[model samples]
Target: MLTILVTGATGNVGQEVIRLLLNQNCQVRAAVRNPDTATEILSVHPTAGFSDHSIDRVPFNFTNPATFATAFQGVDKLFLVRPPNLANVRKQIAPALEAAKRAGVKQVVFLSILGADRNPILPHSKIESYINRLGIPATFLRASFFMQNLNTTHKEEIKTRGELVLPAGHGRTSFIDVRDIAAVAVRTLMEDGHSHKAYTLTGGEALTYYEVADIFTAVLGKPIHYTNLSVWNFIKQMRDRGLPMDFITVMVGIYTTARLGLASHVTPDVEQLLARPPLTVRQYVEDYRQFWL
Candidate 1:
């Protein structure tokens, strides 16, 4: 069995990847900061029904270099993701990638964002460049906007404020479920022929926030709307809510990119990878309807 080391193992996408890997009967070593917390969380996860011996936990912190080698030891492949708050790529990620290369890991599946190579300002773009510089055999999964945001960052607004607010004015995004991205990542890690290739993972359709709100309303049996706020105002609101400046800036840049209609392109890569159509926004909303209610 190939041993895969998964970073950010407790995160949404990481958890989904772990679930799928376990279902495939692959040996998974989850690199998390807190094994006890991760064990508690995974024990209750809906997809976590396998034996404890199938999934193991190891300590790995991107900001801490001391934990890298131990986590990378005996790992054949790696599933890497940059934590959203860690912007200093050179300081945090570069060393870890270097360590992975040194630890004899053969292949890496990096969770990157769509258009990462084109957007120099984004940390993911820089990380991708660094990965290439190291000459590690890797595949990049440039995933689009995640539909799980409705339950995460935007859930409060959808439930309390009765609206979805962002700076993506009149622009559509090919929002994909993180689970779909996870599935593609699993394939890339386990299957051959994907080395050094970048896959743009997206949902089946491109929909504006307005259209998304319509789906939310229909699914929840209540009225919900999309509010387009100016970028500055959005930043101010996030700042007021105590979000860090770095995170706020990153989010503004993403929404600004969408506002320019750059993130609206729909791709068939997810379907191609999974051999089935990607999940639609309506299906996602219906699946998580209780969150909005």
Candidate 2:
């Protein structure tokens, strides 16, 4: 049986990846910051039909190189994800990759951002370039804005306040689903034909802020509005909301660059990999309706 190490195993994509691999009866080592939180986290996923499989919730901290010594032992594959703190990536991912390579891990599937090559100063790009240099079997899965992102803070705010605010002027996004991202990652890690492959994972269709608002209205059965503010205005709004300056800068850069025709490109890669159609926005809205209210 192939053993896989899953970094960030409790996050959105990581959680989905873990569930899928477990369904396939793969030996999974969940590298978490805390083992005690693992059971509670899986319980919340509500994997009603999922069969129990072997899961080792090991304490692994990316910034701590010593933790990787034990975490990478006997691992064949890794689902690599940089934590939410963009600033700490160098202190984390750089060392983890080295440990995986040293452990003789066969394959590595990385979750990176779209257009990572364009902005060298961007943390996502920096990580992408770093991973690209490693002389190992690597797959970089570059993804655009996720619809699931909205399903979090964006959805709550919209449901509570009836407003969608952002600095994406006239920029449209074909937001990929986290489920699709997970599918690509799992397929890359477990199957053949994906080594050294770079994929731009995207949504089935591109939709602007106005179009997204229409979809929201149809699903929630309530009026919703999309406001496209200037980049400066968006930055100001986020700052006022108490977001960190570094993250706000990154978000604004992504938003403005996206407006210039970066993430608007649609790709059929998800369908190609999954052997079926990717989920549509309306379907996502319907499936997650309970959260919208």
Candidate 3:
């Protein structure tokens, strides 16, 4: 059986990837910072048909090079996820890819953001260049903005005030679901014909914040308003909520990308990969309605 190493196994997309891979006939090694707490971290995900013992937990950290070799050992393919905080690709991610190369990892499927290739300063683009430099056979899954951001980043605001607050003025985002991204990752990792290619993953349709608010209202059976704040006010709001400057800056950058209309491009890659249309915004809102209430 082929063995695969999954980085960021505790995250939303990682957990979904592992869950789907567990249903297949492959060996999965979850590379985590703390192997001891892997179970606790993964318990939040829905585990319908698999047990925790099925996944081998190995210690891995981007900042620490010592854990890289051990985690990459005997792995045929690797799913790489750059941690949100680690923007310095040279210092943090290079060592791990080097270790994976040294360990003879055959394939790599990296989770990257949309437009990473054009944006030179983005860490994902740098990492992509590094992988090519190292001569590793790889695939890049450049996914659009995740729909789950509503449930996670803006959930508090929606739940408490029934408002979607952001600086994305009149911008429509092709918001894809994390589950669809995971499915594509699994395909690239486990299947053939996907090497050395970059796929821009997006939902079936693009929706503006106003349309998103309408969907939320229809699903949750309550009026949800989209509070479009100015860029400066958005920063102030994040600061008032005691968020870190780095995180606030990242959020601002993402919203600015949307405001510029760069994030509105729809793609056919998701349907092409999954053999079906990607999940719609209304579907996501309906499935995750309890979170807003």
> How high is the CA lDDT of each candidate model?
0.89, 0.81, 0.90
**Colliding pairs, model 1:** none
Q: For residue 208, what is the lDDT in candidate 1? A: 86
Candidate 2, 31-138: lDDT as tens digits: 998887876786577333223345788889977787888889999888888876645556757888888888899888888888776767767677777777877788
lDDT of 3 by residue, 1-293 (tens): 99999999998789989999998889999999998788777766743434868999999999999888789889999999998888888998898899999999999999999999999888889999999999999999999999988998999999999999999999889999998999999998888999999999999888889999999988898999999999999999999999888888888988888888989999999999899999999988888887889
Please report the TM-score between candidate 2 and the true structure: 0.93
Tens digit of per-residue lDDT, candidate 1, span 51-137 = 566689998899889899899999999999999989899998999999999999999899999999788878999999999999998
What lDDT is reached at residue 206 by model 1? Answer: 87
State the TM-score for model 3.
Answer: 0.97
| Runs off by more than 4 Å, candidate 3 | 46-50
* Candidate 1 wrongly placed segments (more than 4 Å): 46-53
